[model samples]
Target: MIANFSQYGIKKLFLPITSVVLLVFGSCKDKAQEKPTEAMVEEVGTADGFESIFDGSTLNNWDGDPTYWRVENGSLIGEITPETLLDANTFIIWQGGEPSDFELKLEFRISENGNSGINYRSELLDTIPFALRGYQADIDGKHRYTGQNYEERKRTTLAYRGEKAEISTQENASEPESLRNNVQRNAWQSRKVLESLGHMDSLKTKINNDWNEAHLVVKGNTMQHFINGILMSEVIDNDSVNRNASGKLGMQVHVGPPMKVEYRNISLKQ
Candidate 1:
């Protein structure tokens, strides 16, 4: 009787201990599986069924002024001189009215502290100085940050690098102390809440003072901006310019103190 009682007690203790060890091991295995791999982060260039717009030798298909845009060093160079800006009313309007959905790629270089941008879904405005109405992917040559959104002629920065930091700081500042503490304690769980409430900011950083690659993809109502292969921002094109299905495309040689900007590799995929 004594021996049986001892064996029973040992079995009871061992079963609970074994169960806990198995639970911990299973949890660790699941965590390892849940971690993302490197391949998922890398973006392969364009998928299939896309066409290139620029044919390298000439602007055969593109319709724009040769004075403002010239073929220099095997790249399409758009010069923003004072005379060109004043006399020609310097704007390169792609004669091909507008594309409902397309992808655009270009490489740009600029002088120090220069500012330029690409206008899409824009119209030629003789009265208004700007592109009138459209979306612009901003290029700040001095700051190194590229591919920022200018929606409907609004100049306020819609997104930039360290955006998430700004959002979190703002949220923490605005929320009550009790809620803040809860947010801090359960951050992972609160991701859905933050995203749904427009509290998550973008992760796009700037690329200062050099040649940078800018990629834009517009499909139906969605638009995405990328710099050096990193996605910077995205917005829905529900504005008036987009409603027309097609309009003029312009490059902004922003009015500033004698700064120069250059553009090359102007290509598109339909």
Candidate 2:
């Protein structure tokens, strides 16, 4: 009887100790789950499906004005000099075949007065050398025109910085006098600002003459542009006649004062 009583007492003591241990570990687990610091990781360029396009030493698959475009310091550099100033913009095109639905990413730096851009889903003008007409992810040193969508030699400004626009076809679409760059072109397309991404001046504060990451997410009829990991502008085009789903890609150096633009780490995912 004494042995059985002692056994019962030992079990009673162990039951409370087991309960306390379980409660301690359970409380620690709950506290650990409350702070998910590991899950809040920021990701950049770590996504799948990306492939490097620029070889860093050669312009083998790119075509443009030899005098203006060159490989310098492991970057694709396009510069304009007093002797090479132009009456129109010029482009250094990518010959890597056009992308239909894809994401493009790269880093760029521009001179204080430089004006340049990334042109995609574009068609090279047969009548003009180094001229492409299509969608442009606009970039400029002034930051006033940076991060906008400008259709080169075409429908002009489709979406300004801090804007999200939906473009559709219309029977009669006219360019309002309030619109700038109504450059000798007309399109049966209408653009509606769906929402504001942010304030333009506030967004430009994130950009500078330093190296900035430029990302383009062009899928289906939607095209989004991001600078320094911030969304700058977006356009959803339903204008079938005016939109190009797939075409060539290129970089531009606009006509104006002598300026320089450098690009590196050009990558694409399709």
- Model 1 segments more than 4 A misplaced: 1-47, 57-67, 81-89, 126-132, 152-208, 237-245
User: Would you estimate the TM-scores of all the predictions?
Assistant: 0.56, 0.78
What tens digits encode model 2's per-residue C-alpha lDDT throughout 83-147? 99988899999998998999999999999999999999999898889999899999998888889
lDDT for each candidate structure:
0.56, 0.87
Off by over 4 Å in 2: 1-47, 172-189
Among residues 3 or more apart in sequence or in different chains, the pairs in candidate 2 whose N, CA or C atoms overlap within 3 Å are none
- How well does candidate 2 match the true structure, expressed as C-alpha RMSD? 7.9
Q: lDDT of model 2 at residue 55?
A: 96
Q: Which candidate is the best by lDDT?
A: 2
lDDT for model 2, please: 0.87
lDDT of 1 at 42: 37
